[model samples]
Target: MAEDLAREEPRFPPAEADVLVPLVPARREGGAHRVRFGLAYLALAAVAGAALGTTVVVLDRPGKTAGPEWSSWQPSGDRDAHPRQIADHVSQRYRRPSGTQLVAVTYAGEPQVQQVPLSAVAIQTGGDGSDSPPKFVQIENGLMYNLCGLGPSCAFPEGELSEGGLQLLRREALELALYSFKYAGADSVIALLPPNVGNQQDPDDDTSRTLFFQKRDLARELERPLRTTLLAPEQPQPAEIDPDEGLIIDRLTQPRLFQYEIRQAQEGSAFLILAPLVGG
Candidate 1:
């Protein structure tokens, strides 16, 4: 199967990403949700945007750097960067056709752009049993989010799922969740949540159904928290606003980084055990 993916034609040019997975209800509420594994059988896999438009601010900053590994891996921070230009580039190299999902990861050398079936990651949209293919995607090992937004410059703080807002995102071992897009900003990476994961009424509300837990507990659920980011929301570039004149254009336009295209890459595996929470 891996070889088959390697042989597939390269889709859109390559691309942070955000992922939304619904936590299985402790006792079942809506209905029985079956995880789609029809990779032929492969396997798989935030918040609403209301607060996004208001004059809200993020307190956290990118202070704690994981290492040089990720410092150079994020999208370039050049002040004049335009999301459209980046999207154009990504669309050319990484975008995939129907039923196919593109995952950007580093195996041993160059960042290998592997094609996995949509069933490998997303669940059936429930409306239709057909598989919903995810657009191009790139992921990091650490938990990622925007700290604050002040005009064109948005804050993307790399942290963990220990706080109230993020703790709401925790998942069972080997379980994958999906979040719908909450807010897409010029400065912040696009926010997403499972259609049914959180409060379905609003679809973009983050404070709903929130839970808090010990930092170590979160660390335990994600055995390799820093080495893998779930595959779902595509990463955003600077100046990429969610609701704008180009809303349609941006949603379909994939994002790519000019810097990483040619450099040696160190991304983690797209499909990992994402082990169970053994202990805090």
Candidate 2:
């Protein structure tokens, strides 16, 4: 499944900026390069099966970014019957083009895919609001993207993308959605991260920008040391923001994301990755 989610996550590196408080710049443009955020109404598909192994087929395609814009994102589902007659993990529902809901729920179905060794490259600052300096233009294979417009009234459609091209698509779509939360069995996965990953939340609430996720012990070896927020002391927070837990960041646009909901917890069910901002 994408080489088992890139061998269980730990590949952070795409410019890394993580700005916490340095805002006040919201622009509005009509989908030229496109920027709706909320994955523009959903339609993800995945396929792989020789004799019943990886048969992911979440329905929905024809979005944007020229038909292929995924620096990195994991989450797919589609099941009606036959895949070895389905075993576990089910709550399937897929039909949210404008709402009415029908994405039952299937995490352990078709995720855990990674192919960002480096190909969809594109780096160039001054996206289009040119003042002078802010250039890093580089699109090796080309087909790059940067759509952001949600969360705390976010935005980022001035020229296309800058801030390292939406930090390599929000750090490969938030660690490939936390490396598919133990095969999406659910039990905590919250993310809204962007702004080049690190410190952001100033007039945005939900307990300092919701991202209470946890999952890092496949063997434990990944290190970056910036996280330190269990929350206490009447927590007002923001003394140098940039210590995230699962994922939560958005300078503007690219927060057009989704994924969450699954109650029942004594010590389980907490998949709440937040980032819904890309509508009408």
Per-residue accuracy of model 2 over 1-280 as CA lDDT, tens digit each: 4453322222334654885643754445534324543343232111113212322222222345553322122334642222212211111111122332211222222211132222111122332444544222221211111222332234322333333333333433333233333234433333333232222222222121212233432113113211222111121112322444213344222433332222232343222223333310
When superposed on Cα atoms, how far off is each prediction in RMSD?
A: 35.0, 36.4
Off by over 4 Å in 1: 1-66, 71-77, 97-227, 230-280
lDDT of 2: 0.28
For all candidates, what are the clash counts? Answer: 30, 38
Which 10-residue span in candidate 2 carries the lowest summed lDDT? 87-96
Model 1: per-residue Cα lDDT at residue 224: 42
Residues 39-87, candidate 1: write the lDDT tens digits: 3123211022323322133323245765433111223455233333232
